[model samples]
Structure formats: structure tokens, C-alpha cells
Target chain A: MSTPADTMKSGPRGRSRGTRTVIAVLYAVAVPVVLIVAWLIWAGVSPQIFFPSPIAIAEAFVNTWLGPSLTNDVIPSLARLGVAIVLAITIGIAAGTVIGLTPWLRELLEPVLEFFRAIPPPVLIPVFTLLMGITTSMKLAVIVAGAFWPVLLNTIDGVRSTDSVMTETAQSFRLTRAERLRYLVLPSAAPRIMTGVRQTLSIALIMMVISEMFNTSSGLGYRIVYFQRNYLIAEMWSGIVLLGLVGVFLAAVFTFVERRVLRWYHGIKETERA
Target chain B: MTTVATAPERRRRRLSGSTAALGILGLFTIGALLEVLPRIGVLNRRFFPPSSEILTTLIEQLGEGAFWTAVSDTLRGWAIGLTIAMVLGIAVGVIIGSVPFLRDVTSSTIEFLRPIPSVALIPLVVLLYGTKLQSALILIVYAAFWQVLVQVLYGVADVDPVVRDTARSYRFSRWTQLRQVVWPTALPYVMTGFRLAAAVALILQVTAELVIGVPGLGRNLGVAQSSGAVSLTYALVVAVGIIGIAINLFARALERRILNWHPSVRRDVAR
Candidate 1:
């Protein structure tokens, strides 16, 4: 079978690198510039409640994140996101390694894992709420359950794909079992493991919002719903915008960390391209 | 679960002959534990019902017209939203991707907005459409749209300029050129995008139904939990899982059938 890199989806960058910089700098402003002008026109034609001018949204954005809403809502929401991702990575990796080592175990759990993976995670919210109550841990559990599969699947693939030659060499040297895993198994798998982490992180974030939406208080999702129900349209928009920004921020951080972790792998790809 | 029959191993373990049996036995053990643990007081039977009870609820649900209606409502959102996304995505992708300036300008904007979770829009959707079917459609369409759009952008970006210029010099009509040149190149990417979006749309449909209290299987799931129908809740969950699996399998089959002429399929055949 071909490696993932062979079939990896790559966005065409451009025709040439030289012409990209100048046109790119100017073109960068095109979307925001058009959107802002359209927003102005929309706000002008509409009432304050429905359209809520860009200025109003900016104010509400600050008010929501920096004002009393910060401690009451934003912090708690971020905290849940952090906790869920951490739990997802920890448990997913550990369980994935065991399955990887035992190929039969991997086959045994395939259907069960696929079932959990496919379930619209929010559907599990009601069951979790019933079993665990509407608390922070309950919220985290939903997020973890939703986030776990990608990491575990990737980790298993990573572990299973560890090079036979490398393992044989380690055996020839009579490396200790723990040493073989630490030095040989993990290093080869690191790139794929990071691939899984990236997928799981985004999933964890999505689940965090979904879990908060049901039977809860003091989180981004709850506050967004709360403001809408209360008819605070601008504030609702602010929360929505904030969530978008937070999503982008988290993704950027994940990409940065992934690039750092897989620098050697990426370098190899870059050299091959060159 | 283990869908394929394994080739016999050259270096076989003592228990290798019984591995398939072992996996089936493991599944039964899990089912038995689900039944026994709650009744034995190891788990709370009130909240966590036995497997048999859940299966019975699932069978009863199949007999109810309301359950079928709910399933149809969920499916309607999935179908309508996926269709809209595909149409809009291909159009926007072609328009934006054909122009270098447009692609460069919109890339950052798309990247910024795409990561925003569809659930985050519950408030915005609720504000606009309430718990109506439109609310579910809006969420489903918006979430799935990005998947198709991005893939199409990549597809268009991949169209070789040399081939494009060669066609231009031959004075090929714009429509013919697009049909012969662009469509074939983009077909695989479009199929990939469609499959991804199909799965995503169903997920968002369920999420919208549950979160917005829309009339669907997810809403039914919510009702079961709220009313303390523990067995029915588990049964509904199992039902949803089955639907998810069915959707994935259906999409995969469709993709494979259509792309049979592609090199990817040829490679698989060679293997």
C-alpha cells in the first residue's frame, strides 16, 4: 500500500513563487475591504437590532470578553476546551498503543470504535447528562468521547506501521523492551501521532461547544444561546465572532506545534519537492 | 467488525485459527456485561438500561409512525442541505479558483471562517429561524459548504496552465474547454469533497435537531432522555449510530462506483 504522503491533499500554491508576494499583499485586503463596505451598506439600510453595525459588534466583542462576561463565561468555556483536548490526547494515545501492539485487539475493537466515532457526538449528550449529570466533568466526557477516536485510530496506524527493519535491529542489539519502544517505536510514529493530535484537537473544540449547548451555564455556547434567547442580538453576534476568532487561534497554535514536532518530516518533503 | 477474512499466516500462533471466534466472543462478552452489570447493581440500572431492553425499545420505535417521520425530517435536512452546498460550492470554487487574484484574496477569509464550529451558530440560527426545519438546513448547508468549496479550490488550482494555454490557442470554446479540461480534473476532488460533506451534513443535522429542538431523531433522543426512558435513549443512540454507518458506507460505495476509471481504482485493482 502507498504511504499517506503519496496521496496527501496539497493545495496548489501558485504558478511561481516570485510573483506571489506582491500580488498577495494587495489581494490580502480585497476580501475584508469588500466585506466591510457591504457591512456598512447593510447597517445603513437596516435597523440597529438586526444588522447591528460593525462598530456595535466591535464594542460588544470587547464587552463580552473583557467585561463581567469574561469570568462568568469566556474563561469557563476555554477551560473546558483545554481539559477536553488534554484528556482526549492522554487516553487516546495510551489505548491506541495497546491496540497497535496486539493486532487482534485492533481488529476486535474496529466495529466498536467505528460505532462511537460515527455517532453524532451531541446525541450522546443526553445519555451523558442522564448518567453523569449536567456538570463540568459531564461536559468534558462528551468532548473526550467525541475527540478520542481520531487520535486513537491514527496512533494505532502509527504504531502498527513501525518499521520491521528497525525492530529487528533493536532485537539484534538486545535492546530492553521499554528502550525499544521509547527509542524505536515512538520516534518513527511521532509524525503520524501529531497528525492524529491535529484532527482530535479540532474535534475536541467542536464537541466542547456542542456539549455546552445542552443543559448548562457559563460557557461560549451557552452564552451565545443565552444572548439570542434574551434578544441581545449584537451580543449574540459578538459571541459568535469571538468563537470564530478562538477557533482560528486554536488552529494556528495546533499548526505551529505540529510543524515544530514534524520539522524533520516536512523538511524531507520540501527537499523532495525541490 | 473484522470485515475481511485474513490470509493464513506463515508463522502462525497457537490460537491463530480461533482469532475470528475470539473477536465475536469479545463482542458477546461486552453485550452480556451491558446486560448483567446494571442488574447486578455494579452500574445504575435507572440511567443505564440493559442491552435487551434497549433492543426492545429500538424494535418498538421501528413500529411507530412518529419515529419514521422523525427519521424522514432528519434525512430531508441532510439531502436538501447537501444539494445546496454542492451547487454553491462548485460555482463559487470555479469562479474564485479561475482567477488568481480572487483565490489569493479569499484564501485567508475562508481559512478564518471555516474553522468556526457549526454548533457555535446555534444562537445565530436560532435567532433567524428558531427551531424550524430551515434552521437545521441553514446549519447543515453552512458547515458542509466549506468542505466542498476548499476541495474544489484545490482542484481548480491544480489545472495545468500549459494545458489551459494549449486549449486557448486551439480556440476551444469556453464551455467545451471547461467540460473537457476542468471537469475531468476536478471530478476526483469534487467526489472527495462530496463524501466529506455528506458525512458532515448528517452530523450537523443531528446536532441542529438536538440543540435547536427541531423535530428529528436527535429531538426524539432528547425526549427519551428527558422523560427518563433510559432504554429508549440508548436505543435511539444505537439507531443514530447505525444511520451514521449507513451514510458512510453509502457515500463510499457511490464514490467507488463513479471513480472506477480513475488511476486510484486501477491501483487498488492491481494490488
Candidate 2:
């Protein structure tokens, strides 16, 4: 996790550091541009139907996604992902806390929890569809089911690993269960909880696309498949581009949120390492 | 500190008689509840078959050739995909990590592409290959490759600078330097990546099959759902779950064996 600046400090003894950094930045910028240009050239040369020119994809991207599909497909997908994330965080934290705090409960339910965790959450999509019949609710259920496990499992480990001294100190103060959880246990587990949340974000995004792929009309996943089935090759490629953009956006947001939430944890780790 | 972190988990793994008994009891309680809920009409009978019925259905599936074929199909996709990804990832990661300039050049592009969910490529894959195993392989490889590559890159970056400089001063051949100085440091990270990629490969394998109608347990599960064979779908899910657990156990054991010389594994053994 060392910064590029840190690495550069120990970099080979050579030309000026400033020049090296500028060169590094230029290379970083050049690589992706070069790759895209190469793709464009390849597309223009072969002219395969499946491999549309980058220009054609760009046009299709604006025409297809910047229009009604933005509201119809993209917005709904993001909303479902957003809602499922919230629900997963709440349910996972609640259930995980209960399981984590009680020794007997943790021991008793470990096998059952392991069984469920082992079941790749994707397989539950059909079952959820059958039970709820291809509704938004079912999609939400699919996503939340998939996204919650990391949160739940991490929360259990985090809560269980709370320092024994800290727990005893809280007990000596006669803190009620609610008070202890609020001020002591929860704060101690916040870093791990944030780790879970980070994982949940990606899982939620994946599940959002997945839940839409099955028997649904208006989402990014459906639109992409729809375009493909109709042989709108350019449009399908554009849909994928949009999905990638959304993924990048989610990752950037998660980084921002993690920095804010785990600021103290990072500070502590720095001092401990030093 | 590492031993302290792992001690409780190791103890938990070697479950006491009472804890093991309670765990099994807890599993039965869930099973019994699953059986009772549908029978008592709390859950719909059609969608949520009783546990006994699902167990019987699973047993029936074990005797069927189609079931074994689906299982083998899924495993084939997962294995092939994982092998390709690991090879590509390690090779690319090592080459990139060794050259600071190359690492800097590729970092941004890799970051940009890595987060794009592999499922997003379903449309493109389905278009190019239809429902073939290649479609599933593309998705699985795409998803798993980044996991390994990123970890390996970090591992390479962690190579001790003192040792690297000494190797250079000694005028060791490039291959000798890499083999002697870099590979050992990176092996632990590669193992971490392998474990991660295995799980991801399986998930993507099942996903491609389910969504794209590729031949696998996921395809069977989907077909069962559509056909209203609810118990059969549940059985397929259980079978997939077992496979997942087996893969996980295998990965962990492999990691321990391969990294026995590493401090992380050595510490556990000492404990």
C-alpha cells in the first residue's frame, strides 16, 4: 500500500526525480490510449460484425444510453444495487452481532452458516425467482442474499476478536448490553465492518446485473442481452462500456467512503508499524 | 502477533466433542424447520419442498448420468479457467512488477478494467460463442485473472530491496536473480491469489451456465426451475455447494503445503 512517491524515493539512482515522475505519468497516460487505438485499427481492418469500430460504439453509446435507457435501465440498476447494499449491511450486521457475541451460538451455528456460505449465491437466483416470481422484490432478495455474507462473516470475526480487556472494562462499568454495543463493541468492529461493506458493494453490483439477466425487462443487464439478441452489436458493446463506467464509479466512491470510515484505523496501524 | 491472531481459529477448527455435537444439532434444527415449514404450509409446498424430499431427490440425481455430466462440465470450466488465469496472471504480474516503468504504465489501465464485473461480458461472450464452454471460460478467466495478477504484483513489490541490490552487485544472471530473490517472496501472495481465484472461477462458471445456458449444474438448476422441478433445483444447489466446500478445503490444504517454509504457515505449525 506504499505510495508511488515512496517507491520513487528508493528508485534507481539516475536522472532527475521530477523528470522521472513526468516520464512515468506520460507512460501511464500513453498505455491505455495506445491500446484503444490498436483496437480501433484492428476493428477497422477486419470489419467483423461482432467487433464494431470504436467510433461506432461511441455513437451507439450516446444514442442508446444517453437517451431513455439512462432512466429506464441504468438508473433502476443503480437503485436496486443501492437498496440491496443498505439492506445487506443492516441484516448482516444485526445477525452477525448476535451470532458473534454468544460463544454457544457461534459454535452451534458454525456448520449451518458454513453450508450457506459455500452455496455460491448465484444459484439462489432461481429459487428466489420461483418464490417471488420475477419481481423487483425478488431481485433485491437475490442481491441482498449474495452481498450480506461477507459483511456477516467479517462482523462475526471482528466482534469476537474484541479485546478481552476492553470487554471487562465495559463490564466493570456496568454498561448495559445496548450501551456496550454502541460505544465499545461496535467501534472496535468498525474497521472489519467497513471491510465487509467494501466487499458488499462489489457483490451488490455483480448481483444487480445478474438478477436483471433473469426474466426482467428494464435494467442494464436486460438491455445488454436484448441488444445482443437483436444483433445490435454496437449497442451491446456500449452497454458493456456503461457497466464498466458504473463499476469504476462504484470503486471510486468506495475508496472515498473507506478513507473516511477507516481513517482512525489507518492512523493506529501507522503508529503500530512505526 | 500472527500466532495470536490465528490461535483461536486453529482451536475452533479442531472442534471439541461438545461443540461438534452442538454444530450438528444446529444443522438438524435447520433441516427440521425446512421440513416443517413447507409441510405446515408456512412456506409454499411447490417452491419450498420439505428437506426429506430434497434429500431423496438429491439421491436420485446421484444415480443419473446427466447429473454427473453437469458436475463434470462445471468442474472442467472451473479448472481450465483457473489454470489459464493463474499462468497468465503470474507471468504478466512478474514481468510488470520487475520493471518499474512497465508497472507504472499498466497500473492505471489495469485498475480501470479490473472492476468491470465479468458478468457484464455475458452479452459479448454469448454473441461470440453462444452457449459453448468457451463462453463460460472467457467469463471465468476474465474474473479470476485480476485477482491473481494484483496479488502477485503486490508480492513482487514486497521483495527485499537489500537482497535485490546484492543480487545485482553479484552480477547474478537475471533468471537466477528472479528465481533466487523474487520468487520466494511472491509465493505466499500467489497462494492467496490462487485461493481467491478458485472461488471466483467457480462462481463465474456457474453464473455463465445459468445465464447463458451453458452445460453445467447451473444450467440444470435453471432448467429445473423453469420446469417447476423445485426439489431437483434444490438438489443441484446442494451438489454445487458440496463442490464449493471441497474446492475451498483443497485450496487451503495446498496453500499450507506449498507455503510450509513461509512464516505464516510455519507459525501455525509451531502453534
Candidate 3:
């Protein structure tokens, strides 16, 4: 149905490219719209408590999230995520750089670092809760503990891979230690560090939700669980939707930052591909 | 001649041996510190029990039938969920990738759905299935399916257009073309997807159990923590950590076996 012969018979080659773009966009938009309509129809017909209509979800979403829940639940969760992300990145890079630069230390610490990395991240929540209690600091500790490893391990690997020639050149040029670090090391390791940071962001989110799932907390996770336990089905659905939005929002923001930071890396990759 | 050939090899062996020794020494140092810190009141003994106590507690857990059952439950959920996700992912990915119109139609939808983390569905699943294995299964499968699907799609799209056209011109039967061409090209990607999905499936499995109170090691961990069994909690955490490492090693080994012919795997093996 999509053969070149069929398209040639239908129209001229140059015009076909423009029409094809239009068709592709049309198909992309139409599919999701049709699915939503189908969902709306089914949701209307059945109308069960568990399966709330999209309209009901939308209304519940506004009532639950667009009010005090913003301050109490959403803000606290985002705040923890923001703080943990900063702590994880800073600690991971600082530690990773030092260890990576020292051959003996890297060898000594590799297994221990791996063991920490291999720990199923959520398991830390229980241990942290016991040690720190279910407070904000406890939540931050949980998120950072889980999120730190990827960045740390990745940074170590990245730093170790920094070109020896560049370091030698900097030394021969009598560059200051800080200048060598700033110019020769971090930029070279930036791409791998960004990869780790990307992973850390997602892990941080997962840990945030998980840490909130435990005792005494106002968070997106807790709110959703609270709604479920209380049989507020629509509100629960709304809370899940809000969580999804947060994930999407975070990913979008990351993509923007990654593009800016990795522009040089992308340029190099493009040239290499060419 | 023998001395010359073996000189570099001997040095390499010695270097590796020294590294291994250093690694073990590091482990011992940490262990000693952990054991001493609590005893000397540098760290709270209640919160950070000595390493020896935790190890003893772990040995104690190894004897318990319920512990094994919980471990098995987690493994079972992970296996079943990963299998379902792989099957559905490969089947759907192949179909979508083979059709240009379908791929274009679904690309945006897939992107939109992919970023919505599967853990977000925990509430809905809990509402539907309560704290059962089925609730956890929903989360595991949801997270894992996308991992496999995205990889399979990339693999299928990577099939060479010239090779496909040549096969079409030869009138190779669809089944034969798929078997000889598509499957071979897609197998490496499938292996990569399987590895990723394996990790995701385990994470989601543990998360669901821990959060939803399902019957798994994760739930056991929660039970231990809440009951104030401090040493037992550390023991369970260590057990789960070991399990995670084991799963990772198993996935890598399986990937190597399945993708032995793949250039990446071959290069890795050669190295």
C-alpha cells in the first residue's frame, strides 16, 4: 500500500515529498485522537467506580492538584527531587574524579562501588527510614543514595578515559592544575557525565515516589496511595496522571539541558558519522 | 624464546593479582570499620549493627523456608513478567516496524506513553488487583514492555533496504525472508532489549512488592524494618543486593551466549 510505484502513479515525485510529510503528520495526530475518542466512548458506556471517565479524571485532577495539594504534596516532592539531584551530582562527580584520577584508589574501590551500585535501589528506602526516620532528610538521603551510584560510576569511567596526550600537553604548557581540570578533563568527560546525569534524574524520580510511599508523608506518591485506600478512585486516577505529567515534564527539561550541554559532542559525532 | 613470550603475560598476571589483593583488602578494611564504628559508639549501634552481626543474621535467614519462598516469589514474578513483555514487545514491534504507515501513526503515541514511568500505574493496579502478585506483575510488565519494544523497533528499522528489496525481487516467501533476514538482524537488538528489560522487570517487581505489600522479598524487607529487627533488616538488604548482582550477571552471560555471533559481543569476548 505504501510502495513507490503506487505513489508515482498517484502524483509527481517532487510534490509527493510535501504530500507525504502532510500525510505522516495527519496519521500521527489522528491515531491518538481516535484512541482517546474510543476511550471516552467506552468510559461513558461502562461508567464503573474503578474505571472513571476521562472527564471525571480531568475534574478530579483539577480539584485535587490545582489547589492546596500543590503546596503540600507536589512542591515537597519536587523539592526533595531537586535537592537530591543536586547532592547526588555534586558528590558523585567530586568523588568519582578523585578516585578515577588515582589508579590505586580506583582499583581498591571498584568492587565496593559495584556492590553499592548493584543494590536494588528501593531496598535503601527501608534502611534509610529506620536510620533517619520518615522525615524530609530521610527522603533526601534515600534518593541520593540510590541516584548517586550511576553518576559516580559513570564519572569514574569517563574521567579514566580522558586522553593522556591532552593531559601531557597541558602539563607541557605549564597550565595550572585547576585550568587543566577545567579545560582538559571535565569537557572531555562531559558526555559520559551527562549520560550518568540522565540516568540519575530518572532514578531520583523513582526514589522520590518510593520514599514517599512509606510512613507519614505528603507527596504525589502518598496522595495517590491515600486516595486508593480511601476509595477515592477518581482522585487516585488523577494523582497517577499528575505523576505521569511530572515524569514527562522532567524528561522534557532534561532533553533541553542535554542539547545545550552536549552540543559539541553531537557535532563531533555527526562529523564522525559523515 | 619461552621467557620472551611469557614476560608480558607474567607481568599482566602479577598486576591483576595485585589488583585483586587490593580489592579484598579494601573489603576487609570496610568490614572492620563497620564492625568497630558501632562498638566504639562512633555510630549508633541500634541503627548500624556490626557487620558480623548482620552476617550472622543473614546466615540465620538462609535457614528460613519463608525467606526462600519470598525470594522465589520475586524471581517468579520477574520471570513471568519479562517473558510476557518480551513476547508482546517483539510481536508488536515487528508488526509496527514492517509497516511504514503504522510506524508513523504510532511513533508519537509511543513517545508520549514511554516517558510515563510504569511505577505511576501502581495505584491503578492496586485498585484493580489489591496486594496480589498480579498487582506487581502489572507494574513489572508495563515497565519492561517498553524497553523491549523500543529496542526491537530500532532493530527492525535497521534492516538494510537493499537486502529487503533483493529478497522481494527473488520472491522469497514472507516467512522465509523473516526467518533468514529479519530475525538475524533483530536478534542482537532483542538480546540488548532482554538485558535491559530484565533489569527493569526486577526493579519494578521489587518496587511493587515493597510498595503494595505483595508476597516477595521486598515485602519481607518492609516487614523486617517496621518490626524493628535491625540486624535482620540489614541481612535482608544484603540478600536483595546479592540477588540484584546475580540477576545482572545472569543477564550478561545469557546475552553473551545468545549474541556470540554479533560483532559487539565477539569483540567483548575477544577483549
Candidate 4:
């Protein structure tokens, strides 16, 4: 597979690097500019109950993020995500390693894992809330449940894909199971496992928000719904924007970590360029 | 020859029987536990509600017109939004993927936009279009489009150069070349994209309803939960899960039928 750098070099190169840089900056600015202009025009022409102008939303965003009143909401949502992701990665990797290492265990458990994964995690929120109650535990439980399967599945796949020659060489050297796993399997699987973690991070964030929206008294999700209920349109929009930014930030962080950890993976390097 | 065939048939029958028996036993065990635990006070009956109660409520909800209305509304939005998304996404993706310059130019923009969760856009959508079908459709479109576009782009870009060269040498028109050479080569990836989009559409459908107060299964779930009808809420949640599973199964079956010629399905069949 050709890398993005190679493609860029080979492709028709009419535009200079400086021109491309300018285009990239303009493209980045265009979306928000268009949105703001549209919002201003719409708010000017017709005032409605739920439609807030860009200026109003900006003011509201400052208040929500900077002010003490709503900062706790962001903290709760972030805290839930942080705790859930930590638990998910730790437990998922351990279980996945065990299952992936043993052929018999994998064969026996694959069906059950697939079934549970197929059942959408959000649909289980009600049951989770019932079992755990609408506390931080419930929120964390839902996020963990939702995020676990992807990482686990990917890790198993990665381990299973380890080169047979490497395993045989380790076996010929009389390497113990633990040593073989530690030296050979985990490194081979790390990139794929990281990919799974990247996928799960977004899902984890989504579930964190949804769980809060379902039952919690505070959080970004709750604040958005709360403000909407009270017809605080600007505040609601601000909350929505912050949630989007949070999603972007989390995804960026995951990608950055993945690149650093799996520097050998060519696809990651290509993706960075893209 | 007769004896050999008979013995193999008998062994196969025995294996299938054991598999079926095991599956049934597992299902029954779960069902019984879910039923008996709450009654025995090991599980909380108030919030958890017995499996039998959930079944009864499911039946009751199914009989009501409101349930059907919600289903239809959800399906309508999901189908319309997904179809539009697929059509436009595949078109744009193929064009960009085929043209190296455009793909390079837009790659950054696509990456930036793709990570923004479609659900997070509900407030902006509601602000622009209010709690209308348009807003719901927009959200679904946003969710479904990116998944398909990314897959389609990769698929188109990955098409075999040999096939393209052959098509060009045969003096095929641009449209003919695309139809004969590009699309068929990319069909498997396109199907995978559609499958991913289907799951995304359902999620967005329910989410849109939950957040925007649109009339769908999610709205019904929200109402039931808020009203303290814990049993009904649980039942509805299960119903939605079943719907999602059914949609997935249907898509998988369609994919198998369409891609029967592909090596992946052939390998599975051989196994």
C-alpha cells in the first residue's frame, strides 16, 4: 500500500505547498463562518423560541465553560468517561488475552461474546439503571459495558493473527506460555488493540452522555436537556457545541496516543498525513 | 457405499441434535432464571420486573396503535435518511477517491468532520429546523453519510489497476467504465458500508427521538421512563433491541446473497 506522502508526491502537483496551506486554513474556517452567518441572518429575519443566534450561543458557551455553575457538569461527564475507559481497557485486554491464547476457550466463548455485542448497549441502559440505580456507578457501568466488546474483540483478532512461525520459534526455544505471550503476542496485537480502543473511545463518550441524559441530575447531557426544557436555547446550543468539541478532542487524543504507541504501523502514519 | 453414507448421515444428525439441545437448554435456563429470581427476592422486582411481565407488556404495546405509529415513524425517518445518505455519499466518495487531487485536498476536512458525533448536532439541528422530521432526517443523514463515504472512498481507491486498464483499452465510455469496472469491484465494500450505516441509522433514529421529542420508539421509551412505568420502559427497550437485531440480520442475509460470489462467503460455506 502506498503511503499518503507517496500519493501526494505522485499526484498532479499544480498547487504549491503554500497555496495548499492557505486552502487548508480557509477550509477550516469556512464551516463555522458559514454557520455563524446563517445563524445571524436567520435570527435577524425571524425570532423563534428555540433558534438562538451565534453571538448568543458564544456568550452562553463562555458562561457555561468558564462560570462555576455549569463547570461541574462537564467534570461529571468527563469523569465518567475517564473511569469507564480505564476499566474497559484493563478488563477487556485481560479477558481478551486469556480467550485469544486458548483455542478451546475462544471457540466456546465466541458465540456468547458475539451475541452480547450484537445487543446494542444503549438499549440496555434501562436495565443497567434498574440494577445499579441512576448514580455515577450506573453511568460508568453503561459506558464500560458499551466500550468493552470492541476492544476485547479486536484484541482477540489481533492475537489470533500472530504469525505461526513466531509462536513455533518461541515454543522451540522452550519459552513458557507467559513469556511467549508477553514477548510475542502482545506486541503483535498492540496496534489492532489500539485501533479497537480508538473505536471504543467515541462510543464510550456517547454512552456517557446518554446515560447522564437518561437519569442523572447533572452532566453536560443533563444540562443540555435541562436548558432546552426551560427554553434556554442559547445555553442548549452551547452545551451541544461543547459536546462536539469534547468528542473531537477525545478522538484526537486517541489517535495521537495510538500513533506514538504503534509507530511501526504504517497505516497510522498514513492516517496522520491524511 | 450404502453403509458408508448411512453412517455419516447418522453422525451428522447426532451432532445437529446435540447442538440444538444445548441451545434450547441455554435459552430456557436464562428464561427461568429471569422469571424466578425476582419472585424469590434475589432480584429487585420493582425496577427489574420479571421476564414474564416484560413479555406481557410487550404484547400489550404491540396491540396498541401508538406502538405501530412509533415503529413506522422511526422506520420512515431511518429509511429515507439512510437512502439519501447512501446515494450521495457513494457518489461523492467515488469521485474523490478516483481523483487523487480532490481526495488529498478534502482528506483533512473529512477527518475533522467525521469525529463530530451526529447526536451532538441535535441542538444545532433543532435550532435550525425545530423538532421536525427534517431535523431528525438531517441528524440521521449526518450519522449515516460519513461511514458510507469513508468505506466507499477506500473501496474505489483500492480497485484493481489491471481492471481499469482493461476497461479503458476496450474503449468503454466513462459511465460504462464506472458501471462495469469500478462499481462491481467496489460492491463488497459498498455493502459493508450499507451494513454499518444501517446500525448507525437506527441509533440516530432513537437518539433523535430521545433528544428532540420526535414521535418514535425512543420518544415512547423516554415517556415510559419518565412516567415511572419501569416495566413498560424495559419492555420497550427490549423491543427496540429486537428491532435492531432484526434489521442487522436482514442486512447480513442480503449481503450474503449479493456477495455469494465473493471469496469470503465461499470460504464460510466451504468451512
Best by DockQ, which number?
Answer: 2
Q: Which has the better TM-score: candidate 2, or candidate 3?
A: 2
Q: How much is B189 displaced in model 2, in angstroms?
A: 1.1
Query: Counting only residues 3 or more apart in sequence or on different chains, how many pairs clash (N, Cα, C under 3 Å) in candidate 2?
Result: 0
lDDT, candidate 3, B1-271, per-residue tens: 1111222332243346788898788878898999999999999999999999999999999999999999999999999999999999999999987776677778888877877878788888888898898998888888889889988998887787678888989999999888878888888788778877888888888898888898999999999999999999999988988888888778867866877787765554464
lDDT by residue (A1-274, candidate 2, tens digit) is 4545356544556777788787667866898899889999998788898889899999999999989988988888888888899999999999999999998999888888878887888898998988889888989899999889988987887888899999999999999999999998888888888877877887788889988888888898999989999999999999899999888998888889888877888899889866
Residue A24, model 3: Cα distance from true site in angstroms: 5.4
Per-residue lDDT for A1-274 in model 1, tens only? 2222222212244445556555565566778888988998889887556568888889988877788889888888898889888889989889988898798887677657767778877787898889999988888888898888878877787787788998899999999989988888877777778867876876787788887778787688888878888998888889888888888888898889878877887898779856
Docking class of 4: acceptable
Q: A100, model 2: CA deviation in Å?
A: 1.0
Tens-digit lDDT track of model 1 for B210-243: 8888889999899888998889999999999899
Q: Which is superior by lDDT, 1 or 3?
A: 3
Per-residue lDDT for A88-204 in model 3, tens only?
Answer: 999999999999889899878877787778787888999998998888888899999999988898788778778999989989999998998898788888887887887788788
**Each model's RMSD to truth, in Å?**
5.5, 2.8, 5.3, 6.6
TM-score of chain B of 4: 0.90
Task: Give the per-residue lDDT digits (tens) of candidate 4, residues A1-274.
Answer: 4545345645437877887677667655665577679889999899766767788989999987778755588876787789899999988899999888876566556545655676556666666765677777878888999889878987887787789999899999999989988889998889778867976887787787777777578888778878876778888888888887887888788888877777776675578756
TM-score of chain A of 4: 0.86
Q: Per-candidate DockQ versus the true complex?
A: 0.44, 0.62, 0.45, 0.23
DockQ of model 4 vs. true complex: 0.23
Task: Please say which candidate is ahead in lDDT: 2 or 3.
Answer: 2
Candidate 2: residue pairs that collide: none
lDDT of each: 0.80, 0.88, 0.84, 0.78
